[model samples]
Target: MTSWVKFTVSIPDTHQDALVAQLSTAGFGGFVQEDDYIDCYVEKKKWTSGVQTRSREVLQRFAKEYPKLELRTETTDVEDRNWNAEWERSAGIVDATKKIVIKPSWKSLRRRDKGKIVLHIDPKMSFGTGHHETTRVCLRLMEYYVRRGDHVADFGTGTGVLAIAAAKLGASRVIAVDTDSWSFENASENVLRNKAGDRITVHKGSIVALGKRPFDLVVANIDLPTITKFLGRLLTLTRKGGVLILSGLLMTDLVPVLRLINRRSIIPLLLADEGEWIGFALQRT
Candidate 1:
């Protein structure tokens, strides 16, 4: 019998996206967003003491920053069963663009979707189902910039949706990297499922694994803080005039992130907002 540790955080609506992004980076998976709270689950085997500590720290910082919000946190342990079925029941086909449709293995597309490119993904606890606003915008930006024979790097490649899309859109080679072992495994499985194993390589680590190799385009659908931390490295890895797409940001994160990008002389190519999330596309100068 498998088990999971579920953590629920009660946060102000204004801070939901930022907190969710932080938790996701801390290796929490299978999130359920509510009106005023977010629930995240991690398999007991993967929920280490360090992860708990980091999650607490993030929540504590938020609490201190916004005392009026009265943030609350709780955790529980429960037996895991039939989560895949639950996920499938809740997730339907996502139309990322006119040309891109994301569907779980269990769902079938309608007759009208015959001409669209479909990405079959089974996240299985990893993120990026193409259902999130951030991922959808990232896919749209990827469609606009990715070209045939382009080499792409998908940083924080949860579930490899973006990397898979790059390959499907004609990238010659795609490197998908994530620090979480589960995400690496899940993304690998999805790559094979999408018949992209021959063109995509999944790595369980950060950008350093690439070792000075530059990519024609780089896509990072991660949080603002994490993206800021890796901004310089991401810029370095992108070829001059190459495209860089970033998502998983909130409206509040826009100013600070843009300041960091401007300091690096990166040119902003596009800015998109969906719901409360934001995505940016830039070109290496």
Candidate 2:
């Protein structure tokens, strides 16, 4: 259980993407609940007076530019840093038709179904230790696209979970890429744990640095704007007739993202949901 500082802001819906991106880059995680408002969660050490000062400076800048926005700050008690809480809280068991099992590094494999494929992940803060709705959706989608001997790419590869899933699901080659150094480092350890070094190559960079390798499958479990920004490039990275799995979207947020994709004429073959989150599987024509 780790402590967190919650900063709330009310801004125009149009500015939400930029604000979230800014906050994320500033080391705060954004949780948006509305078009005009979002909550930013920052760790205690990162929430010093300097952070508050910077927040005010940023708010002032935004207000000067976008006068209708509002800024608010509040402090709340948070559980100690357990890092593995999600796994413990969720019990770390994911069930699906393909009999795939995602286990946390701390727990032993239990109650597994026959013929199940298991992938173990160490609990970490970056993402995709398999506890979030977005990761769940991506994992299921990966089961569909990844076939034996197919090359795969897990863009925004947090904790390397999706990349590991692709490898376990029978993809012969996997290229996992992430802009976050922590995530990339975590992915390296996971690649070794899965004994997939021969099949999975984890790299630190965005799709841009991964170059133009066309893959049989590409999975991106990042937010809507990032997805939209890279959708065309993602399609280009995916071979014709390959599959692309995308998640990390709210149900209400999917329309704009879909509209953007449709603008490029990339029709999705599947749309899925787990809880309030939504995901799509697109086939590159």
Candidate 3:
């Protein structure tokens, strides 16, 4: 039998969702946030307990780092396994950058002059729904960077949205990549849905799995620290003087991340920001 633990935290209402998202990425499931309080359940293994401790530590760290924010933590049961099933009933539409509409399988695409692009996305258990800040920033960057008939490479392609968007923008060929099997499967399905199955090729593996072929443009919406760590490899993947659109960063994280890339001779040509998210357009020098 698997054991589990629950944490109930008193987080500010405004910051509850972000806190939940961070915890979700940390592997603690069962999120409930209401009236300045957040709750979560964690699997009760040694590693999970360590994560719980570390999560509390991070809450304390964040409190010290951002003094205005407040969060409280308590531990709770994995009573209902069927909780995730409720998600299917709540499947709905998501709007992306520039009013782009992403509809779930339950919804139908309607033609409208709302100046919004429509995408058919039945993500199932996959991540990239274009609802996250990082994905949204990347979409905006893709719109700005992709050129008609350009060859594009989308690293960490969550739902193949970036690659499909590139194809929609007239990229002759698109290579979509992700390490997770679930994402790879969903991306392949999503590409077919958008009638981009022919133009975009879905590859399952890390950025390394993408062979030595250089691309006219490479866009990675992974977080700042990851970007910094992989900057060299990313540079090697781009053609001489190709554009790199990097997002999934907070304003505070952008500078140091950019500095690391700058050392590698990558230069930022544009900086775009929305909400607390920031993205950059960099060109190889």
Error of 2 at 104 (Å): 1.6
* Off by more than 4 A, model 2: 1-26, 29-91, 96-98
Over 4 Å off, model 3: 1-10, 20-61, 74-85, 89-91, 110-116
lDDT of 3 by residue, 1-285 (tens): 666666788877766645554554455534554687866765566336667666866587567756887565666654445543644554567667765677766676666625566777766445567666767777777788789989989988877878888888779999989876667988999999988988899999988877788888998876654677778888888888899888766677766876787578877788888777788888877
| Candidate order by decreasing lDDT | 1, 2, 3
TM-score of 2: 0.74
TM-score of 3: 0.80
Model 1 TM-score is 0.90
Best by the TM-score measure: 1
Better of 2 and 3 by TM-score: 3
The deviation in Å at residue 106 for candidate 3 is 1.4
**Compared with the true structure, what per-residue lDDT tens digits does model 1 show for residues 154-185?**
99998999999999999999998998887899
Task: Looking at model 2, report the run of 10 residues with the lowest lDDT sum.
Answer: 24-33
In candidate 1, position 98 carries an lDDT of 78
Q: Could you list the CA RMSD of all candidates, in the order they appear?
A: 2.4, 6.6, 3.5
| Model 3 lDDT, residue 118, Cα | 70
